[model samples]
Target: QAGPGTIGRIVRVLLAEWNRFGQQVMMDGRVIQRGWRETQRGFDDRVGLFWRYGTGINLDGDDTDHPWSAAFISYTMRTAGVPDHLFPRSRRHSTYIHFAQQNALVNDPDTAFIAHRLEAYAPKVGDLVAYTRSGAANYDRYVNRARYKSHTDIVTYVHHGEIGVIGGNVADSVTLKRLKRGGAGRLIDDSHAWFAVIENRLPLR
Candidate 1:
């Protein structure tokens, strides 16, 4: 498992990228479109870098045929020096989500991430919050390593009844989303069918 410093590094990397993308924020269930988008001039190259680091693909941001949201998460984790064994870079969020689920099932001490039901854990900085987009998506579906459409965001901060998460390809750029915390400090967002929060098990500094 990665140490607390690694988790700190991951959060720093994500915040730095967010700033680079103009510090866009999504609040009150509305998107804030103030920053650079993936297709905009002078910004496509950055998206290309995400693709390169996440998928080893040379595709540019203007190529909308491929969604780069997962790539963005991969890039962030990899750039933060997360080990491939703990957090494998992938083009799909389901890959790491599934991996985390397996780690939870086995209670693997070496795994940096462990998946838990939304009610089971309150997310912390560097943890991942994942949700399903399709009607067929469910927690059991990922146990078999099945391909599914999903999205994940890294938790940047947690406050009273609120949490800040950052994700790539949101509103066509890297964006920060503010979500409400429900009873018992659990995360609740009616906008998406959230299934899991991959807890960061790395020791805190």
Candidate 2:
């Protein structure tokens, strides 16, 4: 098991990465766009790094055909010192999402995360919030059969009536999004059809 400070380290790494992308913010249906984007000149190197280090792919960030959001999440986990055995790094978010779901289904002790239905779990800092991005995908959709278009954001802050999450490739940049919560302190569905919240089970300080 990771030491008690692992979760803290993860949060710190996430915030630092967010700062590197110029601290873009999205809140209350309004987007504050101000940051380096993957396609922007002079910033492609960073995105490229995400692909190489996160997914072992040499594709350039400006390659519009290949989205780097999942790579960004993988990069964050790798940079945070998560062991490969505990966190699966992949170019597609569905890979790791499915792994977490399997962990929960089997009660795997070696995994660092467990997938929970949105209503069954209230995400905290260091957890991941996931949503489907296309075609009939939802919480019950089986992810192992094939790739599903989806996205996930790391939970960075949880406070009264709101929670803040940071994701990459949002608006073409690493963006911090603030979302409102329902009376139960759970996320409210919006344009994104949220399905699961991958709980961070690592020891937290």
Candidate 3:
């Protein structure tokens, strides 16, 4: 079983890492302090996660050719000691977003888990918010793959109706982004960068 406060512990690790090196600067970690949120990939390489998950690809370094946000998420999960079978390791946001939806708490109510529609869900610490760049005119098209590229971030704090998330590869660094909800308590669809938030439920510690 995961230790007491396992979820909190994982979040703490992420927060601590952000505090130490996750600053917003172009190619920040190019010299010293080997870190993940650097211009070059730190220790969190993508090959291990993908290969472990049977992706058959071995990615190396912080190569721009290989986006490392997916690798970053996989690293977080590995550091948290989440089992391989529980999460899908991939470069695309859809790989895990679909899994979270399928395994949402609505389908399995006993576990402390759930996924919610981005426009309708409340921001929670440790929740994941996935966004598509598809420029969807409505909610229906937002989830489709016409435009298809996407990004995902981890929500870390909530206050006064706005939520803060830590995401990798923003402005070329690991940075904290603040998000505002619409008057109806939903994500505003007018934003260019984000379209949806997927809450990946964690088992109670």
Best by lDDT: 1
Please give, for residues 1-205, the per-residue lDDT of candidate 2 as tens digits. 4676777887887788789888989876467667777787766888899899998999766787899999998888888778778888988888888888888889967678999888777889999998877656467775453377888999899998889999988888888999877778788747577888999988777
Global CA lDDT computed for model 2: 0.83
**Full-model lDDT for every candidate:** 0.86, 0.83, 0.57
Please provide, for model 1 over 1-205, each residue's C-alpha lDDT reduced to its tens digit, 9 standing for 90 to 100: 4555888888888899899999989876578557888998878999999999877988878998899999999998888778788887899998999899988889977778899988779888889999887665367767777468899999989999999999999888889999999868798876678888999877555
Q: For model 3, give the RMSD to the true fold.
A: 5.5
| lDDT (tens digit, per residue) of candidate 3 on 93-194 | 667765665565347754333456766787677777777655553334543332356777777777665666766555445566667756665655343455
Root-mean-square deviation (CA) per prediction:
1.6, 1.8, 5.5
Relative to the true structure, candidate 3 reaches a TM of 0.71
Pairs that clash in candidate 2: none
What lDDT is obtained when candidate 3 is compared to the true structure?
0.57
Count of clashing residue pairs in every prediction: 0, 0, 1
Q: Please say which candidate is ahead in lDDT: 2 or 3.
A: 2
Better of 2 and 3 by TM-score: 2
Looking at model 3, report the run of 10 residues with the lowest lDDT sum.
25-34
